[model samples]
Target: MTGMKAFFGTFIKEIKLLTRDPAGLILLFLMPSAFIISLSLALEGTFMTVEKSVNKYKIAVVNNNTGHDGKNIIDLFEKSGKLIVLTNFEKTLLSEERARRAIIDSDIIAAVIIPQLDKNRDRRAEIKLIIDPGLANEVGSFLQYSLQQYIYISEIARLNIEKNMLQKSIYPQTVEYKANLGTIASNSGDFSIKKYYALREATTDIIPTSVQQNVPGWTIFALFWIAQILGINILGEITDGSFRRVKVSPTSERIWLTGKIVPYFLINLLQVLFLFALGVYLMPKIGLPALEIHNTGALVILTLAVSLCAISLGVLFAALSRSSFMLSSFSAMILLLMSVLGGIMVPKFVMPPVMQDFSMWVPHGWAIDGYMNVLVKQSGIRDILPAVYRLLIFSLLFFSAGYLALKSKLGRI
Candidate 1:
């Protein structure tokens, strides 16, 4: 038989062998879907939880003012939609110890003590706000904003009331206005207030959800899981004399590698589609927000680029690691380390600044960033070109390394 026929025959045999391996099929397909679903479900409400914590603030009001200022301050807190006023606290729990305990226990987020303002001495009110130190800076910021809003509105109300009272003091004097009214008459053409309606809602191009990140993340991980299978296949062929037979034939190493790679590449692409489908459809059905993609074309390009990188890495791993044990161990270490660096285990935003910068060195980093640009940032195809180019470069590097490793292995044989 010709070398091309042998290559095609070997490719068919390998595809059949892979189809028969239940564990490999499960690893490639089911595991990633399950992980994406579980992690997405677990992390779906993270943002909402933080938002709720920030919006619903329990604030204790210690009103000590003798006049209407105390009542007005308390009224302001009561009227606020953001703050839940915790009243009767001063009478029941007068000690600062109790207030501190309340804050420590998270029963109340903050305490606003309205001290008796000496209207004669101080121009501005000295309102003391005791914030929960355990909570992050965001809590303090929100509390400050709420108080400022109240103060602004109250000052405006006071100024308007004073203006009204002052206006009442002066009787409506038509005598002065009557003299200038004739001279003030002017021609006004189309003098209309053009009331422009502006939308108050903020527009975001892309909103990243837990699912969009995790689904692609685990899918990338599972794609690299192909390395173990590739290593096993390469080792098995050598031990069984298939590699010797193929080596002696007219078929080139390139053709043999291509045959092996094509099947896995197609499989990896299918795996990505399955996970993305889960993110797009199944997740939303289960009440989790579906993955939002701005450019599906960009996503497809990224998927293909990442799959090629993954397959090439598998080839390099197989060529270097001659034994199944060594392949499994090295592949696991590499995948885990890359996943961490690539922001698969943890989101990139929460990672240390150094790690965030270091992640760019890995192909997975480029893949996830590209996916995020397409999915979360609503970036177009042009925006993701850098990531795709980096992935291609990594694929080229891995393939080159695999060729060198294979040649070294063959020379020894």
Candidate 2:
């Protein structure tokens, strides 16, 4: 009963100390909100717009053959939403020399040259393509594939027409010619010609908005800074002998440490809620997409788990540091390095493959993944179970190590 009273007393003391520090509270709450809003605004016009616009290909189309087959190919390209076919008054305007120059000097991504079709030949004519050097392989491959699609459809139509003509014994040249035009116009499937953005998962293609990315990322970052401040205060208490006085009291070390951690856990959890609230309601009023929480219950569970991990990290840092400067420097380096590796500064989808694999090793990465699952993927609590379990395991390890270290140090003193 006496130990329980001591625990509540120590917990209240820690809470009072934190409440006394207004600047720290502001750093924990307001700074993340500011960072989320500013970065979301800066990225809104540039990255999102570029990602959406990069799919369109501007290609010069030079049609030299007036034959139905050749004109049909040009018409196919003109109708495709993916390709912007440049039309010049002269069919041969994009000659070999001009086509090369156009690709090098300006907006053209590639050039398609349709050779004159021989009316007497039984074979299909070859199409030549001159593509820009940088994107030559990709653009050229797409053009070839699209061309093949048209050819395959036309060939199928031609075979069917020949079968009918053979049965009727009335093989007219006009019939085959009509089939080619009709096939190009009527028989195309929804084949994606150019992919603008690569998908991370086959199940969903929606990239979370800039707000969705920044809010969770910077919120995680801010939580770490909260831990740093907690460590700094712990260092201060040690220097000033406050921890020594607590050691001499009736409170056991375990209860005292738990008391210290619980308040900070609550504070960090509240901080996350404030930041997310700003992300949801306030950000959209200023022109950003409102933060969408697909599962509020899952978000709460993840946030609670993340807060415990961060608080445990703070306890570990406080246990190891000998001075305020050491605590600040080490905490900053640790958190910032984790943030970079864990996809806080840049989205993980855009990170290098090596970094993406490396991110899974950090608790920050697990937390971010959990938040992204809720926000972008519209995941349920079950979907985030792996991340939540990882976070809990990290907390267990950090707290256990920190407790042992603190006990050894206090035992010597």
Candidate 1 clashing pairs, residues 3+ apart or interchain: none
Error of 1 at 172 (Å): 36
Taken over the whole model, the C-alpha lDDT of each candidate is 0.69, 0.73
- Cα-lDDT of candidate 1: 0.69
TM-score for every candidate vs. truth? 0.63, 0.65
TM-score, prediction 1: 0.63
Clash pairs (backbone) in predicted model 2: none
Which regions of candidate 2 fall more than 4 Å away from where they truly are?
53-206
Candidate 1, residues 23-133: lDDT per residue as tens digits?
868667988888888888888687446434543577777667566655665676677576777765645944445655565555676677666655375345466677653
Candidate 1 regions off by >4 Å? 1-4, 50-207
Q: Which ten residues in a row have the lowest lDDT in candidate 1?
A: 189-198
For candidate 2, give the lDDT of residue 231: 78
